[model samples]
Target: MAWWAWLLVQSVVWCSAGVVAVLWWLWVTKPHVDIPGPPTLPIIGNALDFLEHPVTVNKIRDFHRQYGDLLRFYAGPKLVVLAAHPDDIQHVMVTSKIVERDPLTTSAMRSFVGDGLLTLNGSRWKTHRKLINPTFHSELHGNFLEAFHEGSLYLSELLATDSAGGAAPADVHAAAFSSAMRSFCIASIGVDPDRLIPDISKHEVSAVMRRIIVLMQTMMVRPWRRSLSLLRLSSEGRAILMYYAHLRKSVDEVIALRSAATEEGPAKMRRRLLETLVKPGGQTAIPLSEVQDELMTMAVTATDTTAMLMSYTLALLALHPDWQDAARRELKDVFGEGGDYLRSPSLAELASLRVLESIIKETLRLFPVVPMLPRILTEDIRLSGGRVLVPKGTILYVAPFLTHRLPQFFPDPLKFDPSRFLEGRSGEEHPCSYLPFGLGSRNCVGSQYARLEIKVFLATVLRRFRFLPHSRWEDLENSVLSITLHTFKPIEVYCVPLQESGL
Candidate 1:
């Protein structure tokens, strides 16, 4: 053979050898877990499964039913293990070695949130968490009551206007999202939306946020699109970048306005979370870039998750009028039957809302806004009483959606029984089983704030209007697990004035 032909043959042989060597290495180091899941396709693994069914709650349930509590699958070449059993979840959640979130998901999130708490790992996350913790303290919650009340009132008015005095049905999610966004702006960012961006409406802001979140979710599940340079070349990626820029510009305006206001002296500054983060005393001052990222993270998480929680709770209450009546009775007892139903509940009064709280808890149990918590293993770990070995560098998904539905943890898990949470019933369950706000050191820090906001909104809405079932109320079960949980269609309900209902 000629020299050129010999050289080509040699290159082909070397390339083949290299590919075989890599395959051998992967096979030798792959996770030894004996868990069963849907058969994976070569290179792609079970990625097509996710692509076919992007909203994976039902599929996950099917897998848990077919396979046992612990199941293994893959996203592209990444080895993924889903831990549905409380024991396995506990092992993953509490283990110090499993501190890092899945890098692929984190990389996707970083485009929107930068190095904020949601995407950050290690000491940086620890520091930011410590600094932000005091802002959500119960003592400080009272400071946000005015904003929450105002937002609640705004929602009531919006609903009233949209429904034309109870003659029409309103999209509960949209209204709740608007209300939550308005409240988040005032309470967390210390800027009034009306004053800061007079040109922008709550609906506009909410729509932009929803688009951004949808884009982020898309990037998360489709790992191949995570490359920023490549993603920016696509239309969907460009739209997301535009949406993120729009959001960041708004937040940057707030930061600039708040920073200038801070110069006027401490007396002029209200005790808003942005103020605390911008000028966190005696600690390392958070960088401006980090502050922006943190605010963005707070904006998406606080508003979207809280809105979904409120929507789901209201929808469930509408389906179950007895529970609604029971919640109203509790509200009546706290605020009085003849008093102002629109009045804002004080922190103590909000705390007194046990029945309402139970209903909210049950709603979360049924539909956790963040269904799956993804983490990457830093060290090899044995689960299932040492029967299965999940190798280091493997991706682990501690699925609260699946774990919360386990028959062992929650009896008849599909049923929406608010009473299950009342009287300390939830305390009897495994610690890792109920993870609506997540568990362990890295759990959501804004959980208390979220609960407070949801309570205020629910109390205000329930007091003003009774939620009547809409034609699509049963569709709440059909949810899409985006960055946050969303239904296949917007959740709609008829809001009847309490006066008309003669409650």
Candidate 2:
């Protein structure tokens, strides 16, 4: 036995471990995509360039314009591939076994959203979808439609007040949008947020809504917090990683309150979303935790996204008064003097209101509710004549912002025309090209609710008043693509009361 022999063996072991660490570090930190980009730095990766612009979709467009359809970017240590072409998106969404929603994306969602069907995968997503599908069934759509109509009526009443002695233009986003959307959300989930949550202040709801946006920004900007994640250390670029922690705590409280309230039955139900979730199980029963997760996600999602759409739709309608007038004509033709806005119109009824639907489609086209959804690679696969090693965990992002604006799909990409959708599959190109609610098996569960909400709001608003854009119209545009595509500037418009306004 010799001391030198033991020391030599120890040194050899230490050297081998160093080599392995270096290789692992290289693999983890290196940019994996062959797609051309503006190069990168050492440890931080291509994060700096990606962050240069607030909208991720813009960077994706730049890359797509240069590299075409697919380009690679890294945020901290994670690799992301941006795809917008319909075929490419189809592959990622439909599955070739190479791409699905990545672990990190799932982790972030599960962290913020809990185990709502949105965050689940495979059997889990499918199972939840089956159980929850019936919730939207059983005449609930009609009920939610009625609720949406009520909220919309309340909104129209508020806007009518703003028309007081003819105010030239009003800031709808600042005044009407947030409040109206909050009301709609409350009604949709079948609860009044003003009364249920601990604080009953509008300012309080507004503040939390802002926090949700901030948390979403943090998710996009500082997506991967890396090694310090364990200690919960804030990295240089991590924009409010700590904020999400608190965000979750607040969500947990909401969850707790919801659980406690259910002991009393339907009358005690504080969330209409809860009504939808449990209404399906009926005598059978369902998981309240899962329902809570869906509710939490829907509350945040419903508030932010619906507000964004309402603002955008307002601006678009203002820009195209003809479409607004046409929709009004159609409404009058169908419902007459005593028609109910709350009732769910038949498929034919919805179909006949082609212009309204077109305007809605156009609004969604110009500014998608959520610009992009990130998918992950489940297995290795090939796309667009290239065999890229997708591995088991690569992120694939599909941007509706880019897809909707594609020149091939819609001519004069920037122009606002409701006729595009009015054409209705006749000479219309690319079915998968314009998906605002997402598509396939995992399409948004609340899409039916969302669409009905929009229609009801549009019906109530247009029936009563016409939106006249103030000077702020040009300034209010959706340039940011965070959790939802939204206008950085508040939209201000004049409320012009119609005969229906009782003015």
Quick one: best lDDT, which candidate? 1
lDDT for model 1: 0.78
Q: What is the C-alpha lDDT profile of model 1 across 1-503, one tens digit per residue?
A: 99999999999999999997886566555555687889877656777777764554566677789988888987655788888888888788775447789886788889778889989989999888888887787766777888889889988998887777778887777788778878888888777777644344555555655555666667877766566566478775565566567678887787667555535355632355787776533221588889889988987787778877877887788889999999988888888765465566898999989999999998888889888888989888989977888888988888888877777777887888888889776433787888998887788898888888889988888888888877444588676666677776667778888862227
* Clashing residue pair totals per candidate (backbone < 3 A): 0, 15
Per-residue CA lDDT of model 2 for 62-101, tens digit only, reads: 6668876667776555677777777777776765633245
Number of the predicted model whose TM-score against the real structure is largest: 1
TM-score of each: 0.89, 0.78
